[model samples]
Target chain A: SYYEKVGFRGVEEKKSLEILLKENPLDLEKLSTFSQRFPLPSMYRIHVWKVLLGILPPHSDSHALVGGYRKEQYNDILEALHVMRYVNCSTPFTDVCLRMFQLESQVLPRCSETTGPDEENEDFLSIARSMEEIVDDPIDCYWLIKCFVHQFHAKFGDSIPHLPKSLEHYLSQEEPRLLRHLKNTDALAQLPYGLWFRRCFAGCLPESSLCRVWDKVISGSCKVLVFVALEILLSYNNVLLGISRPEGVAKLLCNIPQENTDAIVTKAIDSWHKYCGTPMHAV
Target chain B: FLEDVKCQAKAELQSSDGRYQAQRRITQLLQTELLQLYSRVETEAPAGTASGSPPGGRADSYP
Candidate 1:
């Protein structure tokens, strides 16, 4: 009886009712009427309707069953479906919402003025927050660092080709505190090589004359720090990839005590040489 | 053979234009897709300490 009122033909069975809906979609008036009567539809029924709407041939169907909804309404429906445990069914709708959001954002006015010192500080804080969120997952950190490097490239242009140096200058100027924080947290020890490269080097350097400046800055102290950071990063990678124990690295590090920073620099250079000479295929 | 050469030249010109368009489209798609993917993950991921648990836990450890 209610089915008929909603433009669904069958009177007896729900399956017959579903068949009628499939064959003949309800008009807007009938849909509103049904919504008024039923109030909230079952998740399963909503998912079924979504699938039908997605796959139905364009321009052939008589009734525009779900045609007039806005992007936000569609997003709300998908979110509702997700909350109701219909995640698998909600992906297409989610994708549509994502696309719509992208389109809308692209059309919005761009902020063109150069960010002042305070704004830059705020940006650094935001970046720090993002870094903190991703610290535990090396894979995620790798991509996040890539994004940061890209942002630096966009801001400073291609004055520096070396990604690591560009990042070092950017970080040193924008958020020296982040570098200090990272060192204090021993985050370099836990990061993978790509992420470590991104964070420690790329986040720190400037875009101007990086190659010449980089060599100049690689003094004994900086060299020692870089070596320790690289070792930690490489060891983390080895652990993650099930590579053999970095015994060679350990032996090299053992030769240099923690206090002899100059010796650490020499040992680090030697260690890098030895590691680089190892068969590339082995890595 | 001359006609074939003309056709080939025409096709090459079309292909060159098509390739440029395709490359531009791919670049746009990649930029948009990567941004969307990053934002989606950022929104869905737990903030602060909640994300501190390693992804998929210790079972996901490399060794």
Candidate 2:
């Protein structure tokens, strides 16, 4: 009901989404093309992402399970954020959140001008606080979806290119010059996208831009995570090529490149299409 | 400026001693994560090769 009212509502989009959702084996190709171009209607993101990530089992009852999983886990992250801000840090979740903050502020791509030294907002806490019943803020959904993505990454890390290899492979094909420049940065010297990937590109991407990319990711393949990330990083090719140090490279990539999220998503789609065209490239 | 001060003031005023223990804890937390990431990925792909393999090893084809 909420999703019908708040998400997946537009007539054409609703029809398309309905037809696509009914696929038995899931038409990932069709799903991929559709989602890469459009954001899932706001209320519809979590479940679609679950299906795309294979977080939800391929069964008829997945729709019912989505609500239970989202509510329970969203509260857990909120509690974890509260513990970090108020109580003494004891568990692994606080550690994870802290790492998330560091990755965003330091190693992820961010804008230099707007990223002043302002850590005042219990930004995570406020994010948790602001979440509505069905969740408007997908940041929490990131933690949840990312849990699924991490499982996919880890389970497949040994098989598919792990995050670092994904980055190395993608860069080799797309941004050779920038790859050469970052050869020495401590972070990248060993694995440029390792920490970035472990953190699920949280700090590295803006919420809006990341959500758009996640839309494609949830529908098609988790491998899209690395490709879109590569897409984003390669979009910064000129900037990255100029910076030889890993720290500088990390900072450049960590900052959200610009405010126009749609532009970034559009560019990433082009990169995704091109990368996917060379079937064996980085997937 | 005010945001920084408020953030700072909140942490600083957390106790009479004026030390925000959370900063130290957070820094330590981040350090742990970096170490874990390095050990997990680097020992495997030191050369930064395009396959997720340990040194001198070949990647296994997916089943």
Best-performing candidate as measured by TM-score: 2
Residue A237's lDDT within candidate 2 is 71
DockQ values for all predictions? 0.01, 0.01
Off by over 4 Å in 2: A1-14, A21-39, A50-134, A137-150, A153-155, A159-161, A184-192, A258-261, A278-283, B1-63
Q: Candidate 2: lDDT of A221?
A: 50
lDDT of 2 by residue, B3-51 (tens): 6446434432332121223344444444444455556576666575764
After TM-score superposition, what is the CA distance of residue A9 in candidate 2 from its true location, in Å? Answer: 15
Looking at model 2, give its docking quality level.
incorrect
Q: What is the Cα-based lDDT of residue A25 in candidate 1?
A: 42
Model 1, span B1-63: residue lDDT tens: 999998998898789768766865775676566556645655788456475442223222211
Tens-place lDDT digits, model 1, residues A1-283: 7647655532323443343355444332333223222212232233222322232222225224323223223444344323322233324322323222323335311223223334333333333344434333332232232334334445433433343453344345545654444445454233333322323332322212121112212211122224434433333333323323344333332332334343333344455334333222200
Show model 1 residue runs off by greater than 4 Å: A1-19, A25-28, A39-44, A48-102, A105-283, B1-63
Docking class of 1: incorrect
